[model samples]
Target: MNARLVVVAVGVGLSVAGCNVAGSRLPDPHLSGRDAQYMALVPTADVGAAYERYLVDFKTSEPPGSIVVDTKNKFLYFVEGGGKAIRYGVATGQEAYGWTGRATIGGMQEWPRWIPPKDMLERWPHLQPTADAGGLPGGPDNPLGSRALYLHEGGKDTLYRIHGTNEPDKIGQSVSSGCIRMRDIDAIDLYNRVKLGANVVVI
Candidate 1:
């Protein structure tokens, strides 16, 4: 097989954002804002009780609304002050596909579009690398799902994001390219709560 084909095959099996997930179910982007569509997209796969939304007793000096990604446990925590946090389940990068360090939520969007970076295309040359990368527009199958939080450091785009993913099975699994992937509901909730310029620590 050609390199492109090899990469494409790998992507389909290892990552869900390449528009090729096993037993895919994506709704029209227009309905993304709806909560019903999210539960329908993956009926059997729930992020589960451990990953459910809840306020937990926690200790953190950071003020509320701060985002913390505990990739080892596949959980994202939104600091809610007073020794409390709203925890959400997430799908982090697989193996060596993750990123770390500190950044701020420099920007946010609803039903945001996805444009595969050049490095992404280089690894998966089978992808168009243009047009569709940006053309995939925000929607149910858009990979970005209902919301996105762009992480930046020192006012510069770090290219890492906390966003929504449609692939349900990917939840709690190391299955993304790099960005932290949360369910549509969880993402929308985070999007609604996280303040712009909020500190994000991916540890």
Candidate 2:
């Protein structure tokens, strides 16, 4: 069977209701080196097959290679044009902390060191210790799990990211402060496909 057949067999429905919280098998062809090693030890999340990555029939005006994040549905779409896109499950920001707007992928990193932003520290004073300690080093234990795509707006760092998350179980929930979170493996997959300065639309 061809790729299209495979997608059809896997089924393609971007709906968020009544999803099963069961782990889905995923491909790691893009993973390598430290990414492979660390991700191997991270347990797969039960985000359900609906939330698993898939090449689906999509309708969007965004050009191919651009990212459109549906914050409401907890899904992110990497537009592939021709009415197609690669959809990945995501953990978006909570209502009070949500951010929706256009941005660009100004920076990208693998196993990126995470320094809690100043505002984040202000919001949660307990994290001041981590901030004073110069933040957490990147690894499986870090909140920014395996990769980070820094979002920038108006040529300035927006302090928001579409990055890997240590809290994989939150994949389909609205739980983060503001950044978008993906499973470690999925982050690596997206990292491989995204290029610097690519457009990102969060809605």
Candidate 3:
């Protein structure tokens, strides 16, 4: 073979080898690292639809002192009266469908830690240690992203939360274990507005 041709062949071989190595190390963009922590949580097709609808302008007629949670539609409306309501996109319970009735916002927190429930750990052994350890630290990576509003009824914790999620893409779907999740930014805005001990009516 010609000397120049032989050199070109060797260069081509090295290029092919480099391409293979680079491809192997590339991470899966579709699967987020935080997603692994919540075993039951998964992406749904409805999330995209929720985002689009939320952006569009619509007339809201809910009255003040009422909380309307349209789970199927993925919206949480805090009525401000006079044919107006503050609408917030939310992620609802994945398994516990259509939670109705009234409750109160017992407490609120910023960057709240997430403690896995006993039943959750029992179902998924991977969460055993974390369950006993108390909970995940409050941060961007935490499932509860920025804020949490604890729900109570008759002065007892209902174990339900209106909180923030790091998974902004999952907003507006039934994808959480049971908590109502909002985007981190939106939740922070809400956290500032809603007073503690406010009445919350879910529909």
Candidate 4:
């Protein structure tokens, strides 16, 4: 090969390699929002087999103006009308299980505080003493990873939240205390689309 041609080919190869690396580092499609505090890059190894069964495609058929949570399937469906829905993987209550009801999103916050209930402390004695001390500060380490949507019924707090989790592996599993947990990126995306007072149906 000619010397000039060799140099040009080497440059092209380097450029292609760079593009591949950049594309590999791109965030998952289910995550949205520009704030770094609301985003987390979880390792695929940690997530392992938990979400292996979940369908990655968010598009579906369920209709608009309604939310459906299928705990058995570890999926949350947002009806988008016209026989369509957006499915997201989720984590459900582990200890205090089997919650099925109708509720509305009362409010939402970014990186909200976590106040452990007395019951929770009692159930896990190791969490006693400081469990009722008003809670943990919001951050990446908090159980409520990035965003939180407080649920309510008849204008009263239901003590449940549709929130984010630091444990990406927990997605598509029953592993939370009582709240509904989602991947950080997916939760932020849902938070942006859902309005306060929107209906949520857990089944």
Find the candidate with the highest TM-score and give its number: 2
Writing each residue's lDDT as its tens digit, candidate 1 over 1-203 gives 00110111111111111211222122222333355664466323665566656656556666678887777778787887776676777998766577777789999998787777766777777776555645577667778777899988778887878988878668888888788988787787888778999988777
Tell how far residue 166 is off in model 3, in angstroms: 1.7
Q: lDDT for each of the candidates?
A: 0.69, 0.79, 0.60, 0.62
Q: lDDT, candidate 2, residue 61? A: 67
**How many residue pairs clash in each candidate at the backbone level?**
1, 0, 0, 10
lDDT, candidate 2, 59-175, per-residue tens: 776778999888877888887788777789999987777888788999999989888787777777898888888989988888998899998877878788899988899998989
Candidate 4 runs further than 4 Å off:
1-34, 37-63, 129-133
lDDT of 4: 0.62
User: Which pairs of residues collide in candidate 3?
Assistant: none
If candidate 1 were superposed on the true structure by all CA atoms, what would the RMSD be? Answer: 10.4
lDDT of 4 by residue, 1-110 (tens): 00010001111110111111111112454534534624544322244333322222233332355566767667676655554445666888773454667778899998
Stretches of model 3 off by over 4 angstroms after superposition: 1-65, 96-98
In model 2, what is the error at residue 32, expressed in angstroms?
A: 2.7
RMSD of each: 10.4, 9.0, 21.8, 17.5
**Model 2: pairs clashing at backbone N, Cα or C within 3 Å:** none
As a TM-score, model 1 comes out at: 0.78
Instruction: Show where candidate 1 strays beyond 4 Å.
Output: 1-44, 129-133
- In the predicted model 4, the residue pairs found to clash are 60-84, 60-85, 61-83, 61-84, 61-85, 62-84, 63-79, 63-80, 63-81, 64-81
Best by lDDT: 2
